[model samples]
Target: MSRMWLCAVSLAILCALSLPTFGQTFSRILFDTDMESDCDDAACLAMLHALADRGEIELLGTMISAKFPWSGPCADAINTYYGRPDLPIGVPKGKAGIQQGSKYAEQVAKQFPHDCPLYDDAPDATRLYRQLLAAQPDGSVTILTVGDLTNLRYLIESEADEISPLTGQQLVKKKVAHWVCMGSRYPADLDPGKWGNFKPDAESTVKAIEAWPTKITFTGGGKFAELISTGKRLKELPQDNPVRRVYELYFGGNVKDRHSADQIAVMVAARGTGHPWKLVTQGHNHIFPNGTHQWEVETDNPRHQYISALADGVDPQEVIDSFNELMLHQPK
Candidate 1:
């Protein structure tokens, strides 16, 4: 071929490679969890699977944030049920203590095997976070934290040197377009107990918010997950469904009411729906001995961003309906 013809062919190939694929629109998400806290994590996992089935999001990793011996296998089993056993699961290296009065502890102990096998060969929490973030294009990733912020803190601290001049928060601000977390309260609502999955390490949470470089949107309080009740909605699925089975075993056919905060948090983080909740502009104030953290709205506070409007009213029925549709339509 002539030199001009060869150059033209190379240009054509380069253009083809540069064009984005059909699947590129979906956002990549890292689902950080502390499973033993509540059933909301399980519900959140179900929501993630539903979205993946609909091609709305790509699940990068599911790292275990706190040590709940049974959580590893429980997460693996749930992932296996969702048909995405390849997803990585990470547990805190060394930590102990189940969140107070965990109802799932006995269930997890009875159900999850002692020799809990990991579902995939994921690196430790820090490395996994770094790998996923580095692999994605800048400003394209969204880190969704539904559990404790341990893994996120690790990622921020470990990768700080790589971003230079950009602190972990700054890097997250620049590279990660959004950080959606499920913690805190609605303004001066000093009700920490009401914030279901946020008690494990309130101090860490305070530090994380203080250190966070970008604005964060939170979804929780007395009103967030108050819509979904477990009973009939969970029973709607066949026993074979992994999530349904876990639900059955844990609640024993009596799934009258349960905490849905984590699930609602996941949905808001993943889909950006629900009521317009307020954002804590001043970041975290003192975390009291009772677990509640304080916040004050500031005109130009750089530490945090509070979302006050309830984008939509709480609709557990709608959530359940969406979940059913996703499961029914999932690819064979």
Candidate 2:
């Protein structure tokens, strides 16, 4: 071929390579977790990063609802381990300061190879939310809250400020597509004591739940209860892996798997329904002030939905196994 023709062919190939590999656009994700207390939250973060590596989702940033000193560091360390060292970190400061003793946060932050600044050296949750939201295209963000409603409540109640010209409610309606939260109890018949996310900050839960305008998928306690597994599979991977260390710390070398709710939230958010698991839109979830929840089949509320294990093709145990498999992959 002539030199000109060869140049044209090379240019064409380069342009094709530069184009998106698939027609599907990845979902933008903002992870909110209370990683200070439970290793399940750490597991959830690992799964989310794995999904991001698969191009199934885009992990935009992380907001720590757990105010303990280690919360931000743990989130940053995990994100950094996934090769995203610059991921934004946000922390919420309540009266509960430094009450956290994460089994692996300090360890990961100090010993592991990561670059998350200081533990508490991060932006406030609302400010970071506003900054990130303002930068995103309209109707493009999906938030996953597997922790207290403290940050979310502040974001919901915030008015127009320096971050963006839109109010919190308006911003959510305009910018956020939906949110998948790990809280509440479904079926309305379960004992209130079964729920946990509501109480630590009941007022925030009520305000945020009542005010959010976009669609919400609540991954409550009942449906995802079966996502348990012995971290043995994950532990054998690598000692440098934060997730491996987390499992070791939480389980103390036990061979039995432990139930984790946050993993379900992340799983549903990334690969959403129909792969055996599906959502039940029959009714909406009701949030009480005392942090207890009941799912009432009310035609009045259509903007909310909850996860269920009753789908035709779904085997709860199989779903749990698949999620566990995702968790076992070493962080890239």
Candidate 3:
């Protein structure tokens, strides 16, 4: 080869070597949500897309763990509004899963400009999870949830299939790094039995907790008073923004008295505990099938912990602001 041709070949090889290896860059996230009852699910969806738009994370897809009339469309509407209408979506249409009614999903879908004509028209979340996880490199993807554990349980219990030869738990153990979620009050502040998401699908939640052989991080279940999130401010967005509209319908244009657990968890998943956020990993979480759970703090080695308050001197307002900036962020 001539000197110039060899130089060009070497340059091409260098460029190839510089490309991101599935191992490089931001965390790969597969977000699962129970969009049935909370508008924060929509807000978290917006934040994920915002992070994606900024190249902070690659949003593999979103799955709706709860079944509602227009849950899938509401998610699609947000994805479409964010200029990523082609993003894959999944939902459960099975009787074994949690089925909850949504106050906003149906209305938002009917009023929004998205292309989803039917909510259940989407694929199954379990299958989607398997296919997505199977294709990802080992310990490279993060499955973040802001909803019931039904889907997590179902996905964990899924058997080996064409997607990959690995069983559900095996696939998770081999592929997923950890689970970032927003549910179940920690420290036993409230009865774990009555915990919101866990009890709705208690059996599934228990199964999910037992099946997963990895670390699970929980955040925002009436524990972090410093991370309270409100959608009243999101109501300020112009009427065309479907996310804002979803909030309006849920909170009745009032952001006060609402928690941002789901949004904060998603933000933590995207931005990590870089500044204000901190983790309490000194202990593990204790979950039960009756919808009750608690954080067992231990000084010895432990595996689970929820999000603690802001780092020392970090204003509590900044904590919520972090969530607001991303949750209400517009697509760039």
Candidate 4:
């Protein structure tokens, strides 16, 4: 071949090598949740594990933001049931966090098979975040929070340790692609203390969001999420399914459908919008001192996004069906 032709071929090969391959399509998620407060968290975990089974995503670890003793074990039990028994589980050891008891966490932990017996026995979420992030390739992990932002706040404020030389903020900026938070009401929450995730640890929410170095997407259970009640179909799953038991216990044995805030957030994290949903990426999220938040649209704003309404002509049931199907998914 002529020298000019050989140069052109070499350049084409380099471009092809630089392009993303199918292996890079799957998201590596570090899931953080305030388990035990709501059955939706359980549903979210089950859905995520199912997605992992389908090879759409890889779950790096699960962190419990709730202080309840059973929260860690409940998460572990669900992870175990999904055949990921070895997945690392972390719990917040800091003072700023939620400590509420759950309607199902204790029961699920007691009835299911798991290795994490106590919340305190698990590693600190901040430390785990550092270690997990330090080990991942830069800009390859997605930090998905479906509960309080307490752990994230702790992670951002953490100092250099034996895990890595970089500080918490630096490590996050280096490793995390973006953060998907399932908190706050859409547009604005006129009621300052209404949202559980933000209100209980409002200070942490402010600290985490303010200092976060990457793009942040805030998703909520209000609006479209409230319209998508789910888990009623859990009755169809075998009694051995821990998530099914979670729904039953949460409803006092009724197993009725419930609003899906965290579940929707999980869907958005795993599969980017357009499963009948879209993202409003032009605004920034403004969190108040009292924990309520609002989205202010700015043409130049590019770091924040909020889950918006369904695409035109899309039926609400389509989302409902999708959530229910994932929740009812059989463990692989």
lDDT per residue as tens, model 3, 1-332: 69999999999998767543222457899998878787778888988888787677899998888777578888888898898897788886566566678778888887877775464577888898898888898998888998887778888889999888989999999998878878756566346445477778778877887778777777756757435656667766777898888777876654443677787787677766456666777866677657676677654235466775667788777667766777778876
Query: What are the per-residue Cα lDDT tens digits for candidate 1 across 1-332?
Result: 79999999999998766442322345677888777656657767877877776667888878877665566667766666677777876655524223433456446545533334542333477655665666677887777888787666655655454525445555666667667777655554466556444566665565565566765666664554555543346666665555555565567655445656666565556665333333445654444644565565444556445443344564457565654454333323
Better of 2 and 3 by lDDT: 3
Cα lDDT of candidate 4 equals: 0.85
Candidate 4 Cα misplacement greater than 4 A, ranges? 1-24, 298-300
Which candidate ranks first by TM-score, i.e. highest?
4
Can you list the residue pairs that collide in candidate 3?
Answer: 192-292, 192-293, 193-292, 229-260, 232-255
Per-candidate count of clashing residue pairs (backbone under 3 Å):
15, 2, 5, 0
lDDT of each: 0.60, 0.75, 0.76, 0.85
Best-performing candidate as measured by lDDT: 4
Choose 2 or 3, whichever is better by TM-score. 3
Between candidates 1 and 4, name the one with more favorable lDDT.
4
Winner on lDDT between 1 and 2 is: 2
Cα TM-score per model? 0.74, 0.85, 0.86, 0.91
Q: What is the Cα-based lDDT of residue 131 in candidate 3?
A: 89
Off by over 4 Å in 2: 1-25, 94-101, 117-120, 189-192, 227-230
Least well predicted 10-residue stretch by lDDT in candidate 2: 16-25
Compared with the true structure, model 2 gives a TM-score of 0.85
What does the lDDT come to for candidate 2?
A: 0.75
Q: Judging by TM-score, tell me the better candidate of 1 and 2.
A: 2
lDDT for each residue of candidate 4 in 1-332, tens digit (9 for 90 to 100): 79999999999998767543222457899999988788899999999998888777899999988888999999999999999999998888888887878898888899999999597677888998899899999999998999888999999999998999999999999999989998867877869645558888889989999999998888867766778888888999999999999989988887888889998888877876544676787778888887887788854357788885777788888888888878888876
